[model samples]
Target: MNSHPLFSLVAGLLSTLLMVSCAGSKSYPPLATVPEVNVQRYAGHWYEQFRLPNSFQKDGASAEAQYTLLPDQSLRVVNTETRADGRQKTATGRATAVSGSSNARLRVKFEGLASLAPAAEEGNYWILQLAPDYSAALVGTPDRNYLWLLSRQANLPDSTRQKYADEARRLGFNTTRLLYRPR
Candidate 1:
């Protein structure tokens, strides 16, 4: 079979892309969060600053989340995302602190369609970094597969964004792939 030069070039490019995507950050110890978190202070609306690409939030634009402190000390999470066409999607869930956790780690269960009860699949949401005034935060999962940068304001300064990304990189996360959502 005759192999075309263009075909060979395309194959090489694809292989490189695969390798880059598969190779994550270097080995590191478990991810850690702030020593203490005041859940009440952290409860409020936070705009999506930057995030690692994930299928769950693919094609989402103008994403934001609002947290409310429940009476029972749990949290009510409301996430909203608008599409380019102005269509909006929302997911509401409840978050509870992990036992012995200082309100930094939480388990959230969102309500799925057609289910009166909470979804069985609970995801780990950890607050890796937080501003003293609760103005900004860096949230991620245990394995570092998912990450989100949140801010109280919709428009975050470029310098602050870079600072957060650098912090994520220091925490053993691959921030090169972080995507900024529409304002």
Candidate 2:
């Protein structure tokens, strides 16, 4: 009947609208990293100010990360966090600069797997922003799915924290979801 054709048209239009909305939600391209990173100045302990929710650090509190330069020119990364239950957890990993990335992009691999073979894949760690004094840094993945605001001290000034959050917003992240780490 005529109703059959009308229903088909409506369904087609609805599908097209759904597709367009989905595309709009992913408007931003992968994030960009700073042009260069001075590895020496970047190496040190940084306390987490805030971060996007991640399964690995679910319910983590007082999270912190330490980066040390290794003899091989690689980086040793240590991440420590306290759980809500007052238990401390730590993870150690190795990071190497992505060749030809101006030391701004790094590939990191954490130890531990079902087999002894080395990890075939590495996670992308990009330095998005770094304060001139190297006292504060903003790091995230190219996908913009992960973000962290870190500072040399346990507590960063409120103004500095807001500035970083604004930067993240400009970078297309959902800043409202950023969770603060315990002081």
Candidate 3:
């Protein structure tokens, strides 16, 4: 009755579970105290300028995310990316607003199979900031490890970039770690 195989199996299972838990716990700090965001105006296409490296986005990739309101109180999320090799990847997901707010914060899950789960961990997304005119946005995690700068248009205005950076800094984000990707 050798115990080595059983011990190895248990260890592997624990490792896998730990990895999944870590991936699921990704979170960002609430947006720096700011005026309430007009979600209707904020809904639309946004081009990604910079983002913290995630398994979903490639370096030097050009990406866009479209948000649309749903009749059932959910958001239609469509994310498309053009990779460096000219390959396109698209992911569709549903985002539901977290309860008790104006629906500014949401959790988005790309895996459609888990769509029915009451609260799935895979689609944990939050909107960190938005420009008054809906021209730009800053998204990130509570731990400040992940951040994304997005613009309504393909190109972001210099003034808007500076303003977003300043706001990010005030929020205790490490602006230096931001990777400004070229579209």
Most lDDT-accurate candidate: 1
Cα lDDT tens digits for candidate 3, 1-183: 454776667767865885677576534444543345556776789888777677667877888999887778687889999888989988888777666545555667666654443332322455667667778778765556567888888987667777777777787677876666573
List the candidate 1 regions with Cα displacement exceeding 4 Å: 1-25, 113-123
lDDT of 2 by residue, 30-85 (tens): 67788888888888899999999987786557798999999887889899888888
Candidate 2 regions exceeding 4 Å error are 1-24, 114-123
Worst 10 residues of 2 by lDDT: 114-123
> TM per model?
0.80, 0.80, 0.72
The Cα error of candidate 3 at residue 150, in Å, is 1.7
State the lDDT at 112 in candidate 1.
83
Rank the models by lDDT, top first. Answer: 1, 2, 3
What residue pairs clash in candidate 1, if any at all? none
Candidate 1, TM-score vs. the true structure?
Answer: 0.80
Range of the 10 consecutive residues with the lowest summed lDDT in candidate 1: 114-123
Cα miss at 34, model 3 (Å)?
Answer: 4.6
Worst 10 residues of 3 by lDDT: 115-124
